[model samples]
Target: MIKTASKRYINNFKGFSREIWILAIVTLINRAGTMVLPFLSKYLKEDLHFSLGEVGWIMVSFGCGSMLGSWLGGKLADKVGFYKIMIFSLFTSGLMFFGLQYITSFWGLCFGMFAIMTVADMFRPAMFVSVGAYATPETRTRAMTLIRLAVNLGFGLGPAVGGLIIMAIGYKGLFWVDGATCITAIVIFWIMVKEKTKSPYIDKKHPDEILTHSVLHDKPFWIFLFTCFATAMIFFQLFTTLPLYHHDQFGLTEFQTGLFMTTNGVMIFFLEMPLVSVFERKNVHKVKIILAGSILMAVAFFVLMLDFWIGSLIISLLLLTVGEMFAFPFSNAFAIGRAPKGHEGRYMALYTMSFSLAHITSSKIGMEIIDRFGYRANWLFMGILGIIAALAALYLYNFLHREPKKT
Candidate 1:
């Protein structure tokens, strides 16, 4: 029995092409070196001496850049190819962050943040395209999960180390380290990874191609996009407001908040692939999977609403982790599943823009809510939004896929 279980588990990592692993490695290095977003809120308020309102506006600028960049990346990836896009994004974005560290003026800093987000976000759509290009349809979801696993693994390291770096050196150290890691990842990808001329999933039994659908006209996708936007609006508070909550409410230091973020990365790293392997089977309804994740997200903030302390915070983090594990991979797979053969980048770009949309509003909206109401009020609102969004998603899922047994 033990051997059978072990075999199935090990097989989860098998069947992927070599190129997918290379992508995973690059993703790992890039994510591991990520230092800025987690600390950006703190840096703005404390280091730059910006008011919370200013922070909201700056994040909105970042959001606008991210939105445009994502759209551009997707459109360009179809025309130019994913490899070149990624290479340019990683190397250039890394260089830009170093300059970001030195900027002190409000307009200057806003412009710098906008530029960084624009460049950095291009990598996402390109990576998704690369994932689809490299893996067979049979193995594609697992391939996606494998890369996600790598990302989370790096995320696990980045923030914890970031906290320590903040202590050892300071915020400046974070930017330098972030730049170095991005460059390192770019080098690995450039050296080892090559562009696959074609996708591996062309076969009689399961054709990978789909009818090309317009993003605006596709009803299902639009529904999914709205769902993504809503969930991210609440979920992104982790980056924008939750860190501030940890500091202002509990009086936790930067290290402590970073340490809290580490739990998020750790849980996803250990649980995501395994859960996908065991439960996210070929026939499982992606909508059902997404709805389940959304509910857990609600529970996360609900836990926080009930109490505000170390224990509640830990529980909330765990719930949010599990929610992400469920939501992100499946949601991504669904988007990829819907795309036409050559336009995966565009479809994913639109999907990814959902989060970027949240970035535009989540910060400003959250900061406003917290500033006007109390932290508990903000938590309650988040919790309520979570439930409503998930329920709406559930309804949309059933509406979109009328057939029960369909993937």
Candidate 2:
């Protein structure tokens, strides 16, 4: 039975092309080296002596840069191919990281972070485009799962090592390692993957029947994008208000809070790909799956409203993790599936941009709710947002099914 389970787990990772594997490896390398972000706020506050408000502005600048980068990456990928954008983003961002450590002044650091993030985040949509180009329709969701697993694994590894580096060589070492990793990941990618001007793989099943002529006109996709946005807002609570709630309410130490997040990462690494495989194998509609995830996430928040019990936190986290496992990979695949040939970069950019925008707003909104109405209010608010997202997904599912398929 153990052997059977192991074989099934391994099989889920099979059938991916060599390029997909290479891309995953590069992503893993880059993400693992991403030790700078988690510590950025602390570094700015403690090391640079920046005030809290100043740090907030810098972070807002960073978000703005990220949003612009995402849009540019998508637009440029369609114009010049994903290969060039990926290479340029990584290489330039690496150099920027090395210099960012030198910018100690508030304004200098703010501009530096904005510029670096603008260049760095361009890689996201381009990489999504690359995944679509590399994987088939049947395997695309799983392929995205592989990429997410790599990301989770990298995030899991990055912080522990980053802490050690900070203790040994200080924050400067983090900058060096982060920069080096970006450059190293891209170098390996350049060596392993040959650049192509066009998508090598084609979806022969729907060659002429793209859902909409222009992305702007894709009404169902707009609803789908809102679903993505709402889900992200709820998820970002894990990083933002949820941590504070753990500390203030349950008396969880930073270390204990870290463990809760680790649980999330570990679950995603081990379970997400296989779960996606199961859903794909069953021929489940992506929007239906997403709607289910939305409900789960809503319930996860509502579970937290049971503040009388500490175990509610664990249960809520598990539900949230499973919901994330359901929503994110399929969302990626659905976004790609919606795009017409040669327009995938644009579609993916918009999808990624939603997350970026959510990251900017989720913390502010959650924190305000906590300040004004308390943690229970925040949970209720998030739960309601999740339900709204689920409703949007349901609407999208019905909308797509009702649209006449053009053969």
Candidate 3:
């Protein structure tokens, strides 16, 4: 039985195109070097001695930069191509990371964070569009999950290694490593993947593809974006407040905090792909799965309200990781699946923008609430947002099923 299960799991990874595999490899390399972000808030607060409010503002700037980058990357990918955008974004952003460590003042760092993210986040939409181009509709969701698995694997390694680097050489070393990794990943990508103007895969027509109106006319898509934004806000707390809570509540060191985060990454890495494959194979409704994931996230936050035991932290993170495994891959597939043939970049950009916009507010609002009320208030607020998102998703599920089909 165990061997049978293992064989089934391995089979899920089969049938992907060569381009998809190369994209996953490039993603793994880049993400593995992403040690800076998970620890950025702690570095600002503890190392730079920035107040909570100032840290929030700096993060807001970072989000704004990400927002602009997503827009530009999407627009340019449509005009220029995903290949050029991916290479340019990574290489330029890598150079910026090396310079960012030199800035210390609040304004300087704020500007630095924003500028670097503007360049760095351009990779997201381009990468998403590339996945769409490379994978056929039948295998697209699994291909996406494979890429996500790479991301989580990198995240798993990044934090644990970053923690050791901080212990050995301080935060400055993280920037250098991050910069180097970005350049390395792009160079590898350039060598391995030749540029292509159009996708070789032919998309089969489906009823869902009938709603190919301009995105502005799609009320369900807008509602779906809002749901994504809310959940993203809740998720971004991992970088913002959750790390601080690990320290303040449990007196955990950076290494210990990193271990907790590593658990999240590892769980997602191992479980998300197979689980998403199962869901895709079963033809489960996307919004129903997303709503279930949202409810789990809200429960995870509420679990944090039981602050006495450190075990609650573990339990809460477990719930959150499982929720992520369910929500994100389906979300990726849904957004890309809904795009019209020529407007893929635009659709992906809007989808990514929801998370970018969430990043802008999640940190600032979370920090402010922590300052004025406390962590409990922030947790409660996040939980409420999760519930709202889940309700929205539920509505979307009903709306999509009930709406008249386009002939």
Candidate 4:
């Protein structure tokens, strides 16, 4: 039984090509080095002497840059190609990370944060483009799952390592170490990946068919994008709100909070890829899975609302992890399917922008709820929003599958 299980696990990785593996490795390296943002809130509040309100504004600045950067990244990737843009985002972002350590004033930190995130966030759509460039539609979603798996593997490690770094040399060292990894990943990617003029692995489309595909006119894609935005707004509260909530209410240390994040990564790492494969093989509707994920997300917040205990938080994280494993990956598949070949970057960019928009609002909105109404209200609000997002996803599914009128 053990050998058979191991064989199946190995078989699951069979269809992917060398470039996909390289992209996954690059993601793994970069994600492993992503040690700054998880600790940024506590660093701002405790070390820099910023209040929660101030931190919220700082995050808003970061988000503002993220939105602009996402749009620009998508546009540029479509124009110049993913390889050039990705290398730029990685190299410049590493430098920005090194710059972050020097900013002490509130406004200075905000500006610095904005620069780092803007550069860093450009990598998202570019990475998605790279995956689309490499994989077949039948295998594309699984390829995406592999990339996410790499990220989660690194994510699981990053915070645990970050916790140690914070204890050893404080928050500044976290930035330096993270900066080093970003540069390292850039070097590896450049050396390993050769841009194909035309990929033989995936089927090709007629030039004219691609020439006309524009994301701006695609209504169903917009519906999916809005659904993504709503889901992200609720899900990202884990980043913007949960850390402080744990610290303030449960007295969990940075290491302890890191454990929660590690748990999230661990669950996704072990389960998401296989689960996605199984469900896809069964011909399960993507939107229905996403709706289930949404409900699970709601349940996660519901757990948080029900109790202040660490155990409750753990249960919530478990549920939220399941939700993320389901909802997030399929969103990409749906968007990529909507794009024509030439416009993959733009479709992905617009898709990436949805999450960036979420970042823009979630921090300020979450902080306001916590400060004015309290943390309980914040969780309840997130739960309610999750339900609404689920309904939106259901509607989008029906919209996409609706029968066309014969002209």
Clash counts per candidate, in order, are: 0, 0, 0, 0
Instruction: Itemize residue pairs with steric clashes in candidate 3.
Output: none
Worst 10 contiguous positions by lDDT, candidate 2 = 200-209
Give lDDT tens digits, candidate 4, residues 241-344.
99999899889897898778778877787688888888779978777888888989988998997654678998899899999999998887766656666676
List residue ranges in candidate 2 displaced over 4 A.
Answer: 207-209
Q: Please list the residue runs of candidate 1 whose C-alpha ends up more than 4 Å from where it truly belongs after superposition.
A: 1-9, 41-55, 163-173, 202-209, 243-260, 308-315, 402-407
Q: Supply the global lDDT for candidate 4.
A: 0.82
In candidate 1, how many clashes are counted?
0
Ranking by lDDT: 2, 3, 4, 1
For model 4, what is the alpha-carbon lDDT of residue 181? 93
Tens-digit lDDT string for candidate 1 (1-407): 99987776687788888889989998998998997777888989998899988987887788788998898888888888888989999999999878888899899888988888889989999898888888877677778899888877887778779989999999999999999889899999889887764465633245334443476676667777877887888888888799998888788997898778777766776577778876646567777888888888888988887554678998989888888888888888878777766777888899889988877788778888899997888888888887887887887777765633233
Query: Candidate 2 on 1-407: residue-level lDDT in tens?
Result: 99999999999999998999999999999999999999999999999889999999999999999999999999899999999999999999999899988989988987888899999999999999999888876688899999998888898889889999999999999999999999999999999999876665545466423657778898888899999999999999999999999989988899999999989998888889889989988988889899999999999999999998999999999999999999999999888878887788898899999999999999999999999999999999999999999999988887887887521
**Which pairs clash in model 2?**
none
Estimate the TM-score for candidate 1: 0.86
lDDT of 1 at 161: 90
Which 10-residue window of candidate 3 scores lowest in summed lDDT? Answer: 201-210
TM-score of model number 3? 0.89
Which scores greater on lDDT, model 2 or model 3? 2
